[model samples]
Target: MPLKQPIGQKRLTNVAIVKYKKKGNWFETACYKNKVVDWRNGTETDLDEVLQTTAVFKNVSKGVLAKEKDLVDAFGTNDERAICTEILTRGDLQVSEKERKLEYENLFKGVATVLSEKCVDPNTNRPYTITMIERALKDVHFNVDPKKSAKVQAFGEALPLLQERFSIQRANMRLRLKLAAACKDEIQSRLAEHKVIVESKEADGATVAIVCQADPGLYQVLLALVRDLGKGHGHLEVVSLAVQREGMSGEGQASGDIQGILKEQQRASELSQVPYVTSQPASTTGRLRARSEEDSMAEVSYPRGPISGIPDDVTRKPMFLEIDGLQPGWEVELTKRGESGVVDAVFFSPSGEKVGAFVQARRAALSASKKAAAAQSTVE
Candidate 1:
C-alpha cells in the first residue's frame, strides 16, 4: 500500500450559482447559499463568508474558468474578485428546487402574518391569530405567490376570500367633515353609505359640522365629493382612528380646521368670502344661514348655500352624470331649468342601510313598472 494523496479542503460543498450576462457571454460565481441570501437581504456583510472562492467562471457547474481577455472585455476588469462582485450584484440568482419551495413557504407565512394583523372576524369582532389564519388558508386552499409582496397578496387576493369564508372586514375609521351648511344635501347619499353615528351637526356662521364613523374606503370618495360638490368649501379631518367597536364613542375628534382641495380657479371667488369652517371640541357647531331673502336664488327653492360670484349661465351645458360615476348609496339630485326647489328623489330606505338589498328592490320595481307600461299601451 502507498501513502494516500493529501485531502484538499472542500469549501464550496453547498454551492449556489449567481450569473451575469454581458456581451452575449455568461459570467458565473459560486457562493455559499445562506450567506449569499443573507447578504442580499442586508443581514450579512462579510464577503469571505458568502464566497467559497472569488473565481469567475464561464460555466460554474462545468468548472470551466473564464479567459482573462474575455473577462476584461465583458466586465472591464481582469480581477476575479471584482468580476465576481459584479456578477453577484447584477446577475440572476440560480436557486435549487429545494430553495424555491422554501421561498414559497416563507411567502405563505408572510401573507398569513399580514392578514392576521390587518383584519378582524366580523361575528366575534376580534382579530384572528396567525394560527387561525394559516388554518383557514389551508381549509380554503388559498394560493400565495412567491413573487408578490405579503401586503399586496393579503389585501388584493386573500381578504376577499376571507370575507366570503369568515365574514372578516377591515376596522372602521372615524371621520369628521365640514362644509357650507347648505351643501350637506349634495353628498347625503355618500354619507348614508356607512354606519354614520351623527356625532353632531352645528351651523357655524358659514359651515355645517358633521362627524361619523364609517368604512375606511369612504374617506377619499368623500374628499372628491367635497371637491366636486362642495367646490372647495368642505374638508374631512381624520388623522386618527382604529378598528370599529360599539360606534363613534371614542374620545378622538377632528383635529383642526383643514380646508378641502377647492378648485384652484375658484379659490379667490369661493373661499375668500366664506369663512373656513373649523371643528370645535366634539364638533359643536352653530352655522349661520348662508342665504338671504333678497337673493334671487333663494326664491327658487330647497336650501341653497351662498356661493356668490359664480356666474349663473344656463348657457352651461346640462350635466349628464355617467352611470359609472354614480355610487349606489348616494341620493341623486337633479334640477330642471325652471323648477322651484325640492323634494326627495328617494322615498324608501332613507337611512342608507342594506344598500345591496335596496339596489335589488329598486331594479325589481323598475322592471315591474316597465312591464305594466307595456301592458297598458292603449293605441286608441
Candidate 2:
C-alpha cells in the first residue's frame, strides 16, 4: 500500500501527464512542477523560470501553500500564479513550539507588570513587586490560548487570579450625630441593628449627641438609613481616619479631647435659635414683642374675626388645633390674628376637634349659595 500522508500535511500527487517527442515515438512522464507549452516555438520551461523575467516576480519566499486550481483562480497571468505558489510553499507560516512558549511568557510578564502598577498590598499599602506577583501566579493553574492576543489573555485569565489572591482592605470611619428628640428612639434602634461602636452619648437638653466608629463599607449603608430617618432635621458629620498599618492598633491610645467639639455644637445651637422679647403683653392680646425696639413703639393691631363660628377671645389664648389629617392627630397651636388668619376660614367638628380650613370654606360657600337660590325659587 502507498505510504499514508503525515498529519497536517496536504496531499499532493503528480497527476498531470507531460508528453515529449522522441526519435520514433512520444514519451510521457508525470509532471511534479508546473509547466507551460509554447506552441509557437515548441519550447517548455519551468514556471518559476518563466516568472523570473516578469515584473510580478519578487525575491520574497511564500509562507502558505495553495492548490494549482486556486492559484490559477487568484492570479490573471501564469507568471503571477507561479510566483504565488513558490512563496506559499515555503515554511515561514508555521510557528515553532519554542516560539509559542516564549510568546506566552512575554504575555504573562506583561500581565504581572500591569497588576504591579495598578494594585497595592492591603496590609502594607504598598504595591507588590513583579516577582511577588509571579510567585502568586504559580499557585494558580490556568490555560492560556495562544490564538488570543496578549492583552486578552492577560485581562481575561490572569487579572482575575491576581485580584483573587490580593484583596483590598475596608476603610475605617468616625461619625458624629446630633439627634432630634422626636427621632432619637428610631435612630438608636437603627444604630444598634448595624452594630456600630458607640463611643459616647450625651444629652444636651432635648437633643442627644452621639459619636461612633465603624467600618466604611457597613457605615455607608447605616448613614443612608440615618439620613432618611432625620428627614432634613438631623445633623451628621463624617470623618475619614488614616488606615491602620499592619500590626498596629489604636486601642490603648487615649481618646482625643472632645470638649472643643461639644463647645462648637453648643455655639451652633445658640445661633440657630429665634430670639423673642420677654416683656409683658401690651393688652392681653397674647402677642409678644418681636424684640425690634424701633418696631416695638408702633402699635400692632390684632384681627377680631371669628373662626368657624367660634368667636375670637381676646382674653383667652387660642387653643392648640388638633387636626385629624395633619400627621394623624398632630397638634398645631393657632392664634387669632397670626399665621392662622391667612386662611379664609377654619372648621371644627361638634366634638371641638379641628377638621380642615380651606376645604371647609369651599363647602360652606357652596351651601350658602344653594340656600339663596332655593329661597328665590320659593318666592317666585
What RMSD value applies to candidate 1? 23.8
- Candidate 2 TM-score versus the reference: 0.25
List the RMSD of every prediction in angstroms.
Answer: 23.8, 32.8
What is the per-residue lDDT of model 1 for residues 236-336, given as tens digits with 9 covering 90 to 100?
A: 88833434221111011122111111121123122124433211111112111211211223232222221121134522112211111222222322222
Candidate 2 residues 1-380, lDDT tens each? 99998667433243223333223322222223223222112244444432322222111122132333443444434454444344333212333467557657765776666555444333222234455555556655645665455446555677666455333223346788887777777877888888776778888778887888665667567667667877766777775342221111111112212222223223322322422221211111111122122122433233322332234552221322222322122222222222212112234443446544433433444555577688889999
Give the TM-scores of the predictions, in the order they appear: 0.45, 0.25
Give the backbone clash total of model 2. 3
- Model 1 shows how many backbone clashes? 8
Candidates in order have lDDT scores of 0.55, 0.42
lDDT of 2 at 245: 19
Candidate number of the best TM-score: 1
